[model samples]
Target: MERGFRLILAASLMLMLLDLCRGSTIGVCYGRNADDLPTPDKAAQLVQQHNIKYVRIYDSNIQVFKAFANTGIELMIGIPNSDLLPFAQFQSNADSWLKNNILPYYPSTKITYITVGAEATEVNSTSLVVPAMQNVFTALRKAGLHKKIKVSTTHSLGVLSRSFPPSAGAFNSSFASFLKPLLIFLAENKSPFMVDIYPYYAFRDSPNNVSLDYALFESSSEVIDPNTGLLYTNMFDAQIDALYFALAALNFRTIKIMVTETGWPSKGSPKETAATPDNAQTYNTNLIRHVINDTGTPAKPGEELDVYIFSLFNENRKPGLDSERNWGLFYPDKTSVYNLDFSGRGSVDVITGANITNTNGTTWCIASSNASDRVLQSALDWACGPGNVDCSPIQPSQPCYEPDTLVSHASYAFNSFYQQNGASDVACSFGGLGVRVDKNPSYDKCLYMTTGSNKTLSTNATAIPTTSHSLAGKVHTSKSSWTFMISFLLFLAIDSIRGW
Candidate 1:
C-alpha cells in the first residue's frame, strides 16, 4: 500500500510537471506577402495583446522580426522560395543573409526556427527547396546557431499519397526521392516535419463526398482510420494521424510532426465557394478549443497535438484564388473578421473595416502561461516551436494511457501529494483572467480544483488572480532567514533535477 501510494503521488507530480511544460500560445503564420498590412510594430502590439508567443513567417522579414523584438514572442523564420537557388548556389550568401537578417535581431526577438520554404513539395519550385534547406543548415552550422535555431521546411498535404482512412496514408512516390533524405536529415538534426493541413479544402473539393458535420467538428458524424482500427471523429485529427501513420510506415516514428498551418478561409470566390466568416469562425474556434484544452486525437490519445492556425491576418495581395487571400481571422487592419466568444478568454468580433485593430487578451494568457516558466526551460521548448502538440477538443479517441504523473513527480523529487500540492488547481487556472480554457456552453462551472495548503483561494483566483502563483509554486524563499535558507538550499541542490 505504501508503494502504491508513492506511485500515485509520483504520477500526479509528473502530470503537473507535464502540464507545467505545455504552451497555450496559438502559433499563427504571419505572411507579409501583401503590402497592405499593419506595420510590424503595430502587428507586434496586436500579437502581444493576444499573448501569441509563436509566430511563423515567410522570408526573414526584418520589419516583421524587428516588430516582434523584445515583445517576448518566439519566431520561426523562413527563407523564401525565390531565395532558395541563390542560397543553395552561394554558401557565402547564406552566411551573409544570416548575419544581415537573422543575427542582428534574434536573442531579443526570439527567432526559434527557420522554415526553408512554405508548402515546398506541391509548389512549382519544389526541386530547389531541398538543396536550399541544406544551404541554410550549412549556413547555420557556420554561424554557430545551428543548435539554437532549428532548420525545417513546411509542406502542403498535397504531397500525401493517401490520407483517407488515415492508416492507409502514404507519401507520393514523386516525393520519396526528396522525402527519404529529408526524413534522415530531420531525424539526425532533431527537427520536426511541418505540414499545412486544411480539411476545408478537402470538403470544398468534394462536399458531396465528405460529411459537413465531421469537417465542422460537430460531434455527430464519426471517422475511422481503417488501417489502425482507430476512429477519427474529425477530419483535422484524421489528417494528422494520417501523416503519423504514413511516417511510421516509412520507418520513422520519432520524427515529430507539427501542423504548421491549418485554418479555414472566411471568404471565397464563386467557383471556389464554401468560404464564409461563420464557417471560418467555427473552424478556427473549434480548433482553438481543441488545442487549448490539451485534447488529443484517436491515434495519440492524451498527447497534446501542436498546431498553428494558417494566418494571423488576411493577405490582400496573395496571388491565388479568392480563398487563398481569405484564410484570416482578422482583416489587414487587425480587426477580427468574425464574432466569437472563447468562454471569456476575451471575445473576437469586429465590424468589417480597412484600418481596424483587434487585441486578444485571452489568447495571449493561454499562450504565455506555458511559456512563462523558468527562462532556461522556455529557452529550450521555445526553440523553433513547442512540444508541437496542441490537444484537440471533444475526445476524438479513447484516451491513451495517462502519462506517468507519479513517475514525473518522483523524477522531479516533488515532496507533495497532488491535492496537497494543488495540481488540479494549477490545471484549472487556465480559464478566465483573459486565459482561454475550453468550455461547453451548457455548464456554468468548468473543470476546477481544490487548493493545497488549505488556503482559501481568492474568489477570483482562477480568473483575474491576485498573483500568478496562487496554485503553482509561488514562494521561492525569503530574506532574514539566511542561515536556515542556506541549509535548505544546500539540501535541495543535490535533489533538484536541474542539478541532478
Candidate 2:
C-alpha cells in the first residue's frame, strides 16, 4: 500500500512539472483601437488558435473580460491614463472599478496584472501613477486579491536619460521623484516593473547608429559595453539591461521586469521605410524565439522573461505616424498579416488572399542531406524515443517504411516531431541533423504531417493518435530528463499495479 501511494505521489509531481514547463512566455497586446477589429470573443478565439497564452489590453473592458472568461489565457488589463486621478484620490473609486470591471470576470478570466496608466511620463501624468497604483492595490487587498493580481504602471523607454552603454543606464533626474517611489512600491509588493521597449523607434530615429539587423535580433556582430565589459548581441537585450542597470542603480535590483509592449509595424509612411511586413515578421518572430529560449540579457543570462507583442490587430484610430496604426499581427478580419509562430520554434509563411483558414503555410522537416546516416539514425532514435514523436507509422509494413533508408525514416519521424511541436525551427533541428523544407516531401501513400493538418497515417493509412499534437504545442521536454521521468513513471505504475 505504501509503495502504491509513493508511486502515485511521484507521478503527480512529474505531471505538475510537465504542466509548469508547457507554456509560452510570449503574449500579444490586444489593442482594439479600430472599428474593423473583431469582437472580443472572436479575438479571444484567435489568440487561442495561435497557441498564444497571454494577452495585454489597453483598458479593462468588461466585454473583453467576459469574452476571455474560462479561456485559460492570462490577461494584463490596464486602467487608462484618464482615470488615474480619480483612482489615485479615491480608494472607493478604485474598488468600484475593480468590482465592476475585474471581480465579476476574474479567476475565470485569468487576469494576472493590473497596469495603472500606460506611459504616464509620456502623458505628463507621472504624478498620478504611483498613487493610482496604491489605491488599486488597496482595493485588491480589500478583496483578498492583492497577492494574486499585481498592480503596476507601464513606462516608455524615454524614462531613461542614458541607455547607450547598458551598464551606465540611469533614469532621467527629472523623473527621479516619480520613479523612486514607484520602484519602492513595486519592490515592496513583489510586482514587476512593466515597460514598453521599442527598438523600432530607436532605429527610426537614428538609422545610421542603430543597425536594422541589431534591432531585428539578427546581428552577427556583438556590441561590447566598455564600462562593464559586457557583450551585447541585440538591441532588445541592451534596452532591457539598460533598465536593469537603472533598477540596480536605484537599489531596486529585486524588482523583476515585464515587457508590457513591443512590436514592429507592418506598414509605415514613405519616410518610415524600415516599417514593412517583412521586417515586422522578422522582428516579432525573432523576439518570440529569444524570449521563449530564455536567452536572457548579458546581465541576467538564462533568466525567464515574459514579453507581449504590441497590437494584436491594426488600429486605424491610433494617432501619430502611419506606422502608429499598423503594428498588428492580424487584420480586423482575423487574417494573419504575416506568418508568425508564437511557439517560437519555427517561421510562419505569409498568408495571402481570402484563404485565412490555413495560416500555417506549407513547411516540412526532413533529414538534412549533409547529415551522415549515423547522425540521421541517432536523431531518428531520439525523435522516436525521447522526443515523444509518434513513430508507429514508420514501422515495418507501414506506408512510410518502404523506402527503408535511414534518411527516409528519419524524415518521417522528424516531420512528425516538428509538426507536432508547431513546425518550429528548433523542433526540426535534431542536433543539426534535420532541415526544414518548403516543398512537401510526401510521395506514394505515405502522407507526411504538416502544421495545421491532422492526417497522420500508419500501415493501414488511417489517422493515428493526434491528441498529443495540439495547435499550441504545449508539451515540451528535454531529451534526457523527459525520457527518464517517463520511464520511471512507467516503472512505478507497473510496480504499483503488481503490488496492488
In order, the Cα lDDT scores of the candidates are: 0.60, 0.79
Scored by TM-score, the top model is 2
Candidate 1 segments exceeding 4 Å error: 1-20, 23-25, 271-273, 340-500
Which pairs, if any, clash in model 2?
A: 345-424, 345-425, 346-424, 346-425
Query: Residue by residue across 254-366, what tens digits does model 1's lDDT show?
Result: 99887888888888899766688888878877776566554667887655555777788898888888998988767888888885432212221112212212232111112
Best by lDDT: 2
Range of the 10 consecutive residues with the lowest summed lDDT in candidate 1: 467-476
lDDT of 2: 0.79
For every model shown, what is its TM-score relative to the native structure? Answer: 0.68, 0.74
